[model samples]
Target: MPEKEITRISKFLSLVLRHQPEKINITLDENGWTDVATLIQQVNKSGSRLSFEILDFVVANNNKKRFAFNPDKTKIRAHQGHSVEIKLGYPPQTPPAVLYHGTSEKNLASILAEGIQKRNRHQVHLSPDKSTALTVGQRHGKPVILQVDAAAMHAAGLVFYLSENQVWLTGLVHAEFLHVLTT
Candidate 1:
């Protein structure tokens, strides 16, 4: 897939799944899920266009096994509240391993500009060496070290494992990680 396409899908996963809706100050249904129409509207409001079909395609075609269908396929939600949904797909096998979450207190723009720029994976493993990680921690007014179990994610139907790798970076991770690592 094109790099830009990957980046776009990654960002959607982070915003809709990993980040807390309350942080964004949006209310969710009692089921903790949002409707596909509302989700599309939110993306458009955010200056992005993410159709349900795109989400469906991503969830369906992702090689990494990051997304799944809700009980009815009429809606989509993260497998786990803590785990970001990277793509749109239902996997045959559950994922095994743990995922790490990096929280930031910074506003969404800064977080995006610095944290999620050019990532290939669905989730990210955070470290102190990265400025985005530190910024996320600083913004939150606290240090963040998140350890998430992929198998648990799989069981909850939030995250599907792509490979056997134990750790993953959020697909929505800031592009700076790529820029910094590439440089």
Candidate 2:
């Protein structure tokens, strides 16, 4: 498939798989997985041409590795960033001493005042390093990276999980645990 087609399909998949499987009348399993064949059928039924090969291409070529296939290639799901309720089932693990979150400078004040909230998503997403966080921030404009004190939070009885794409997940990061990272 062409690059534009790939991106279009990727975005569509993200929309359906992560937020609204009901849009295509498909259902995700308890752990957020859905049948791959059923997904292709529904996607095509919705007037988007999709095939297992194209799906594989999008999964393999997406820069963030947004989706994954089960070991048997029979199931698939977004790694995280779900709006509708579905458990990802990633086990809790100790994060690095620090993790990074990037956002527009415009949002910094609110973030610093309230810490980071999950908002519409399931969990606050954190990056393992500044560069990735920066890229994420740039999307929102006037990028600003915030350093999170993961160690302190963990010590304070908070839990963290690393998604398949290496994005960090946490229920919350209180304002006290954040520091504006100066580049």
Candidate 3:
């Protein structure tokens, strides 16, 4: 596949699967899976061409590993980062001792005062490593990394989930659990 085609389809898939299934006239089940056949047909109807082969390629090759297929490959769902209301139903897990969050420096003041909020996303995303967090932050501009004391947060009873893609998911990270990671 041409790089352009793959990139286009990957982005479109991310958009629909994570944020707007309605854009393609499909709805995800409560657990976020959508029938693969139906999703492909819907994509075609929406003026985009999709096939199981292409879908498989995107799921396997996406840098973030953002989508997943069911065991039989009959269904699919975004690994996380859903803004649309849907229960991913990922079971809670104990997070690592530390996690990292990346954001633009412009948001530092609010984050320092109030802590990180999910904003429009369903949950605040944390990376297991600083390098991944840095990449995420760079998207927003002058990257700022926040080191999260995950062990402390877990001890304090904050729940955490590990997405299939390995991102950490939590409702919030209070300022007390956060430290600005200085280079």
Candidate 4:
């Protein structure tokens, strides 16, 4: 398929798998997984053509590795960024000494005072590197990157999870553990 087509399908999959499966008449399980066949059928029935082969291609070629298939390939789910309530089932893991969060410059003041909150998403997403965080921040507006003291947070009893896509997940980063890296 063409790149544009793949992007379209990928975004649609992100929408359904991460946020609104009901829009396509499909439902994800408590762990955010859905039957692959059911997803293909429901998406096609909803007027967007989708097939196993196309789905496979999209899953394999997505740049961010946003989606993942179960071990048996019978189920699929987004790696993270779920707005709907669903347990991701990621085990608590030790993160690196530092992690990065990207956001728009406009939000810096509030973030400085309140720290990073998950808001609508399941967890506050963090990047292992500043470049990735900068790219993520650019999506919102003028990018701002924040350094997170992951080791300190972990030592303080906060837990972290690494999603399949390599995005770090945590409940929140208090202002004490956050430092503005770039504005």
Candidate 1 TM-score versus the reference? 0.40
lDDT string, candidate 3, 97-160, tens digits: 9999999999999999999999999999999999999999999999999999999999999999
Candidate 2's residue-wise lDDT over 53-82, tens digit each?
989989999988999999999999999999
Q: Rate the local accuracy (lDDT) of all candidates.
A: 0.48, 0.94, 0.92, 0.95
For model 1, how does the per-residue alpha-carbon lDDT over 81-179 read when each residue is reduced to its tens digit? 243333423244443354344554343445545653224334444332344454445646654433344444455544333322222333344332222
What is the lDDT, from 0 to 100, of the residue 7 in candidate 1?
58
Total clashes in model 2, counting residue pairs 3 or more apart in sequence or in different chains: 0
Quote each prediction's TM-score.
Answer: 0.40, 0.97, 0.96, 0.96
Which is superior by lDDT, 2 or 3? 2
Compute the lDDT of residue 131 as modeled in candidate 1: 45
Sort all candidates by lDDT, best to worst: 4, 2, 3, 1
Instruction: Give candidate 4 misplaced runs (Cα > 4 Å).
Output: none
Q: lDDT for model 1, please.
A: 0.48
Each prediction's total of clashing residue pairs, residues at least 3 apart in sequence or on different chains, is 27, 0, 0, 0
